[model samples]
Target chain A: MTDVASPHTDPEQKRGLFETLEIDTRLLGMIGAFILICLAFTWYTDGRFLSARNIFNLTIQTVSVAIMATGMVFVIVMRHIDLSVGALLALCSAVMGLLQVRILPQYGIPLGSPLIAPIAMAAGILTGAAVGALNGWLVGYQGVPAFIVTLGGLLIWRNVGWYLTSGQTLGPLDPTFLKFGGSEGTLGVTLSWIIGALAAAAAVWAVWRARQVKERHEFPVKPIGAEVALSVVIAASILGFVYFLNSYLIPDARLKRMFEARGEVMPEGYTEGFGLPISVVVVIVVAIVMTIIALRTRFGRYIFAAGGNPDAAELSGINTRWLTVKVFALMGILCGLSAVIAQARLQNHTNDLGTLDELRVIAAAVIGGTALSGGVGTIYGAILGALIMQSLQSGMAMVGAEAPFQNIVVGVVLALAVWLDIQYRKRTGALK
Target chain B: MTIETKIDPRGTPLVEMRDISISFGGIRAVDHVSIDLFPGEVVGLLGHNGAGKSTLIKCLSGAYHADAGDIFINGEQAVINNPRDARGYNIETIYQTLALADNLDAASNLFLGRELVTPMGFVDDGAMEAETRKIMARLNPNFRKFKVPVAALSGGQRQSVAIARAVYFNARILIMDEPTAALGPHETQMVAELIQELKREGLGIFLIEHDIHAVMKLCDRAVVMKNGARVGTVNVAEVTDDDILGMIILGKKPPQAV
Candidate 1:
C-alpha cells in the first residue's frame, strides 16, 4: 500500500503461481456444460419444467436434499462427510413424533394440539443437534475420520428411531404444526422458504460486505469482476423468478375479499398469490446462507485452510479441532430442519422417514464440486448439484424411466462430477 | 522519587532472550543461548546447518517454548509461551516460507488472523487496503499496489508483506530467517533496503542467515553458534566473514578461529 514496488521481481510469476494453484479453468467449462444440461432438461421436459408451478414444485421437492447437501458441502470441504443425515433425520423426526404422541398426551395436550407439534419439532431439532455434536466431538477431539463416525451414527441413529417408535409410523399431528413446515403464507408461498431465503440473503450480504472491506483496506483482495458477475447472475435469476411469479394473475383471497366488499364474488381456486412451498424456500435459503458462511467468515476460511493444508493452518494459529466440531454441529442443525420438512411433506412421522437421504444429499454435494478429500467447494455449487440430481430424476421419471434406471443415471452423473473435480485439481495443482 | 527506569529511550534493546534453552526428544536443540537486540541495529545469528540459530530464534517468536530461559521486552521479562504471546510482545518471525497465503493480498497477509474488522462485524477491507498502502509507503514508497495476492508479489514485495505483518502488529523485535534466500541480487538488495527502513523505525532485528556476505554487510553485531552452543558474540565491525565462517566451522571465538 505504501510503497509502489512489489517484493517479487517477477510479478507475473507470482500471479501465475496462484492461477496454477487455486482455481481450475476447466471448472468454468464444466459450469457452462452444466448450464447446457439444465437448458436441455427444461427443453425436453417440454414447458412443464419451465412453468412457474413445476419449478416451484421442484423447489419444494428438493428442499430436504438441498439443505442437507449444503451442510455436507462444508463437511466435504473440510475433507469429511456425514453419511448420517438420513438416519439422523429419521431419528429426530421419530423422537419428535414420540414426544408428541406420548409425552404431550401425559400433559393433557392432544395429539393435534398446537403446543404438542411445536414441542415435537423443537425436540426433533434438539435431537439432531445433539447427534451432530456427538459426531463433531468424536471426530474433532477423538481423532476419528468423520466418514466413519457419521456413518456409524447414521446406522445407529436409524435403529434408535425405529426402536423408539416400536417400528411404527406415528401421526395425525396438530394442524398448527403445519405452519412450521407444511404451511405456506397466505401469499401463496411457503413461510419456511421465505425465512430461509431471508437468512441466506443476509449471509450473502455479510460476505459481500466483508469482501468489500478486505478490498478497501487494501488487503490481498481477490478480483471483484468474477464475483460481481456471479452475484449478478444469482440476483438476476432470483429477480427473474420473483418478477415472473408476480406477473402471473394470482387469485388472492384478499383481492377477492376486496371485490366482495365491492359486492363482487371471489374467484374459486389456489391461484396467483405470492406462494411457494415452505420447504422449497427453507432449503434454498439455508443452502445459500451456509455457503456464504463457508466462504466469508473465519469459520469458512478455517474449513478451506484445513482442507488445503492442516499443518499450515495449525501453525497459523487456527483451532482446527473447534472448526471441525462446529461444522458437524452446523450440519446437524440443518439435518434437523430438513427432518421437519420431510415429516410435514408426508404429513406423518414414519420410522422410514429420511432413509437414503444421506445418499442423495452427499451425492448432490459431490456432484456440485465438493471433494471427499477436502478443501474445494461452494454452496452454490451444491445447489447446482442438487438441482442436477432432481432434474435428472424428474426428467427420467417423466419419460417413464424406472427407479433402477434413474439410480443408474444418477450414479453415472455422480462419477462424471468426480472425474471433473479430478481434472479441475490437475489443472489447478490442488490435487496430486 | 520514581526511578523512571534509566534506559536509553531510542537506543533501547527491543528484545533480549537470556539463557534460552529448548529440548526436543531429550536432545537440547538450543542450549543456554542468549542474545540482545537494540533498536536501529541488525544482529546476525550465524551457525552450521543444525547450529541452533533457528531453534533459539523460534523460542523468542513463541514457535517453541524454551525448556529453560526467559525472554525480556524493554528490559522486562516476558513469558512468550505461544505465537500469540510473541505477537503480544510485538515480536514477529518471518520464515523462509514467508508464511504468506498466496491467495491473500499484502494487506491480508499483514493483518492475517488479526484483521481490521468493520464496525458492522466484517473485515473492513477498505481500511485494510488503506493501512497497507500507508505501511508500504513508509517501507518502500515505490512498492506496487494491486498485488491482488501475495503470490503475485515479487520476492522483495512478498518479503515486504511478511515484514509488514510484523510491523503492523507493532512488533519491536523482528526475526528474519534467511529473508533474502533464493532471491536474485536485485531482489536481495530490495530486501536489504526494506531492512534498513525497518531499522529506521527503531526496530530491533535478528537476521538468521547462512550468507556471511550478507552478515558482513548488514549486521551491527554477529553472534555465532554451533551444535546447540554459542561460540561468541562479536561486533560485526571487528569481525570478518572469514572470522565468522571459521567460528561456524570450529565453534569458537573469531580470535581463537583466526
Candidate 2:
C-alpha cells in the first residue's frame, strides 16, 4: 500500500498518465512488453554493457529508418505502399556525387562548386518526387496496385542509379556538403540543444492549436487530469531527454583514442572529430519534420481517411486519387533524402549501398504499429521500432552473434511485431 | 406555416427523369418512369428495394444514369453526366453510409471536397473550424466539438458531419437516401429536428425514409412508389401508416386516405 501510494502516484501529476487511461489492451500490452524487454536487456547487459555511449550508437544508426518511417506513416495511413525508396535514395546519391566531380571541372562548375551541388541535390529530390508521382498516378488514376507500381519502380530506379554512376563509385563530397550530415564532426551542443527545443515547441504548438479548436466547439476533451499533467510530463520528459543527450550528444572527446594504441595509429584509425556525425543531424531533422507533417496536416488526416475507406473518401468529394498520388510522391522524396544522408555519411556512392534498406524500413514501420492494412501508424512508433531493431542487432553482434543469426532473430522479431500489432488493433476494436 | 415555391416551370423541373429506364441486362428494373422536382420544394421518393427506388435516385444523383432516361437539372435541359457533374449542378445526394471519412474530424469532413484555403493556398483549417462552428450553431447547438475524429463520434454526429458537408457546399437540392434507416429512436428525433432546421433554412431536402412514422413526422409531403411506378405524391396530413403500407404492398393508395 505504501509503495502504491507514493506521492508521485497521484494520477493528477503522474508521469505517463496517458498510458494508464488507455482502453486499448493491445497497446497496454505492447508497452508493457516493451518495458519488460528493455529491463531484461539492461539486466543482461549489466552496468558496463548499457552505457550511454552504447545507447547513443544504437540511436545514431537508426536515424535514417526513423526518418523514412515518418514518411511511411503517411503512406501506410492511406493504405498505400512506396517501394521505390531504396532505389530513389540510390539515384539521388548518385546524382549528388556526380555533381561533386572536380575531375570533370568544365562540367562540374567550380572546385568549391556551390551552385552545382545545390542543383544536384535539388535534382535528386525532384527525381524522387517525380518517381513518387508516377507511382501515385499508376495507383490512383491508372488503377494499379501501389505494391506493383513501387516494386517496378524499385528495379527501374536502381538501374538508373547504376547507369548514372556507370557501375562506379563517386567520392569525397565537398566538406560543406558533408557538414549537412555532421560528417565534419559531431554537431555542436548548441545545434542539438536548439533542435531539441524546436521539436518540443512544435509539439506544444500542434497540441495547443488542436485543443483550442476543440474547446471552442465544446467537444469532449480528455479529463483535465490527463490533459494538463500529460502536457507537463511530455514537455519535461523532452527537456530531460534532450539534456541527457546534450550532456553526451557528441562522442567522447577521446573516441579516437581507441583508433590509436601504443603511440601508433592503426591502419584504419584516425576517424574524424569526437563530435556527432552530420548524418545524425540530418536524420534528426528528417524525423522531426516528417513526424510533424504526419500528425498536424489536413493532408495527414486525408491519408488516414483514404486508408480507412477509399470509396467513402471519393464520395465525400475528396480527390482521393490526388491524395494517393501525392503521398506516393512524398514517400519517394523521403527515400531520396535518406539516400543522400547515406551517401554523405559513407563519403562515397555505390549502387549496392542501399540494398535491402526497404525491408528494414518496412519492418521498422510495422514494428512501430503501422497496420499492414493501413490507417494505423505514427512517426514516434516507427522510429522507436527502428531503434529497437538496430539495438537488438547491435546487441547480438556484441554478443559474438553472426550476421546470419541476427538476420534470423530480426525476421522472427518482425513477425512478432506484426502479430502483436494485429492483436492490439483487435483489442482496440480498430480491426473491426 | 412554411414558405414554398414552384415557379420554374413544374414541367421543366429543377431535376427531370424522363422515361428513365435501367435494366440489369435480362431484367427491366425501371421500365419507364418520369418524375420532376422544382425549386423550393420537398420531393419524397419511395419504394421497396427491388422496386428500383434506389436505381431511380441513383440516376438523378449521377451514380447511375438511366440507361434510357435523360436527367436535366435547373431547367435549361442539363446532362448530369457524372456525380461530379451532379455536384456542379448543385445537386447533392446523401447515402445511408453518410459516405464520410471516419478518421477525419468534423470540420475536415464538413469541408471535405471544398476546403477553405489560406492566402498562401494551404488548407485553412482554422477558417474551416470557425465556419463549421457558425453553420452547426444555427442547426444544432449540441454540435460544438470540431477536432475529435469522426471515428470516435456517435452515429448521429457522423450523420451531422455528412449533412453539413452537403449543406456547406450550397447544395440547393438534397437527396438523402434512407438517412434515418439505422438510427435509434432518440437519434431519429435528433435527425428529424435537424431536417426541420434545414427546412427552416429554405433548403429543398429530399428526405428518403423507410419508416412511415418518420416520413409522416418530418416530411411536409410524401411520395409512394411500387413496381417502378409512382404510387402517388400526397400531403402528410392526407396519409397514414396504412396508406403507405398499402402502397408498398399493392402499389395503390389506401381507400379512406385516398
Candidate 3:
C-alpha cells in the first residue's frame, strides 16, 4: 500500500509537462485558442488588430459581460441558468440614470455632487438584489423551476426599464460615475506600474507561502525549480501586461484638451499612456475576489458540493434551498455592477441597454469550460470566456464581416467549443 | 472471533423510535413501527424491498419527518427536523446509495459540509487532505486515488469513503443502510471487523440488512418488518435462523418470540 501511494507523493516519478507545471490543461487550451484568434485577426487586419489601443479597447469591451459571467459560472455550476441578467442590467441602469438625473436633484443633491453616484449606485444594486431574492424565492422555496422564473424575469425587467425611462434615453450622468465606463478614467502609467509591481510581488509570495504551508502540514511539496519557474512566469505575465497597456500613448489632441480643461499650458512633447482603464481594473478586482470566493470560502465549497450531488449535500446537512437564494442574489448583484460599467461606458442609459448580453455572457461561461451539467467551473475560466467572445466579435467586425455573418460564426463557434470540451472530457475520462 | 455478550437490553435504550409513522401522498410507507437500540449493540433491520425498512430508518436519520410518534435519545425526547438536527444529537447515517458528490475528490467529499478551515475562515485544503490520508490509511489502506473525484473510484472505494465519513465524526448512534452491499468479500470482512471495533467502543448501531447471515453474525437483536409494520424483534442468541427467515418471508412471529 505504501508503495502504491508513493508515486503520488514522490517527486522522482516521471511526470508530464502539464503535471510538472501544475497547470490545468483546459485553461492552457483556452489560452492557446485566444492567442490563435488574436494572431489570425492581426494577420487579417495587416498588423492593426493587435495594436495596444485595440487591446485596451478589447479589455474595456469585455468588462461588463465578463463581470456578470463570473456570477453566471456559479449559477451554471449549480445547474441553474440566469436569463434575466441582461434585462436586469437594463433595469438597474434605468434606475441609476433616473436617480442621478431626476430623483437626486429633486432631493436637493445636485448631479455633480459626490453623494449622487454612490447613492444611485446603491439603489440600483439594492433593486437588483431584491429582484434576485424574489427570483430565488420562487425557485428555491416556492419550488418553481429556475428557467421559468428567470425567463419571466427577462420579459418583465426589460419592460420595467422601458416604462421607467418612458422610451427616452437618460444620461449625461455624473462625471465620477462615468469614470467606470473605461477610457474616461485611467490609473495612469506610474500608478499602473506600481500596482503591477505589487501584484507581481503578491503572486510570488503566494507561491512561496503555499509551499511553506504544504511543508508545515507534512504534505508533499513541489520541486523548488518548478515553484520558482511558476512564480517567475506569473510575475512576468503581470509586468508584461502592464508594459503592453503603457505602450498605448494617449492621442496628442486628447492630451492638449485635458491640459486646457485644467487651465494649464501643455508642456512640449509631454506624453502619457492610459495604462489601465478603471473599468478593466474593476474586472481585475472582481476576478480576484470571485476566485477567492470560489476556492477558499465555506460558501463556495457548499456551492460545488451541492452542485455535484444535491442529495449528498443535503444529507451532509447543507441548507441547499438557502444556498440557491444566495447564489441568485449574488448573480443579481453582479448584474447591477455590470450595469454601472455599461451605462457609464455609453454615457447614458438607453431603454435597450444590455440587449442580447445574456446570451453572450452564457456563451462566455460555457466556452470558458463551465459544465452546464453542474459541479464544475472556475472564475478565471468565465472571464477568459468573456474575453474570447468579445475578441471574436471585435475581430470579425474589424475585418468588415457582416453583422449577421458574425452572429452565425459566433453561434457555430459556441457549438464547436462545447463539442470540443466534451471530447476533451471524454478523452481524459473525466466524464462517463 | 469472540462475540461480546455484554448487551443489557433492560436499561435505557441509546435510541428509541416509538410508534413512528410516515406517509407519502396517500400511501403509508412506514406504518406504526417501533424499534429501540441499546448502547454498544447492533440492531439488524430486515424486511422485503417495500417493507419500509429504509423509510423507517430515514425518519430516525431526519431525512424524512415522521407523520406521528417521537424519538428519544438517551431517554430524552429528541426533536429532529432535518439532517442537521440529527447530527446535533451525535447521530450519523451512512446512506444506502453512499451519498457522495461524484465531482469532488475523496478528501473534499469526506469534508463536504463540515470542512476544516484555517483561522482566517479559509478552507484548509492541506489539513483536510492530511486528515483524510490518516483516516483512509486506517479504513482502506489501499485507497491511493485521493486526488481524483469519487466518480472515478470503484464501488468498494466509494463505499469506504461513505463509511469513513460516518465514522470520522464521532457518532454515538450510527445508522448504516446496506453499507456492505457494494463491497467485495474482503471489504465486507473489513466492515464486519470495523463494526466489531465500533461496537466495543460503546457506539450503538442500527444495521439495515437483507442478508440474514450478516445479521446472525453481527447483530445482538434482529428486528423484522413486513409491509411497513414490525413483525417481531428477537434476541439472536435464542432465535434460530429459520425462525427469523419465517418472520421475514411469512410476516409471522415465531412461537418463542410470541
Candidate 1 lDDT at B147 equals 40
Report every candidate's CA lDDT: 0.74, 0.70, 0.89
Task: Please give the lDDT score at residue B41 for candidate 3.
Answer: 95
**What tens-digit string does per-residue lDDT give for candidate 2 at A1-432?**
001112432333542434444333444455565566566667777743366566556666676666677778788788877777777788877777777763335664754666765766687788878888888899999999888888997898888979977988877676666655533455645675676677677667766776676587564456666656656766776766556545553333454454454575544433332234566666666776676566456576667777767776666556788898888888878877776667766767788777777788888888888887866787767877887788778877766678899999889989988887777556533454
The number of the candidate with the highest lDDT is: 3
lDDT tens per residue, model 1, A1-432: 233364454344457633533344555655776667667767777756666655655666777888888888888887788999999999888887787767789989886665786788788888888889889999999999887998798779999988888999887766666544533322343442464356547646864876766665545645767556555665665656554444334447666865777997766664554554556556656865785576446677667666655654555666778888888888888888888888877777888888888999999888888877666777877877888888788877776778899999999999988897788666543454
- Docking quality (DockQ) for each candidate: 0.19, 0.26, 0.48
lDDT of 2 by residue, B152-247 (tens): 556666777777777778887789889878666676676677667667766677777777777777776676767776666676777777877778
| Fnat of each candidate | 0.22, 0.23, 0.55
Q: iRMS values in order, in angstroms?
A: 4.9, 11.2, 3.6
Residue A363 lDDT (model 1) = 90
TM-score order of candidates, top first? 3, 1, 2
CAPRI tier of model 1 = incorrect
Clashing pairs in 2: A181-A278, A181-A279, A182-A277, A182-A278, A183-A278, A186-A275, A186-A276, A217-B144
Clashes per candidate, residues 3 or more apart or on different chains: 48, 8, 0
Mark the regions of model 1 whose C-alpha exceeds 4 Å error after superposition.
Answer: A1-34, A179-236, A243-274, A291-296, A305-312, A371-375, A402-405, A418-432, B1-12, B133-157, B254-258
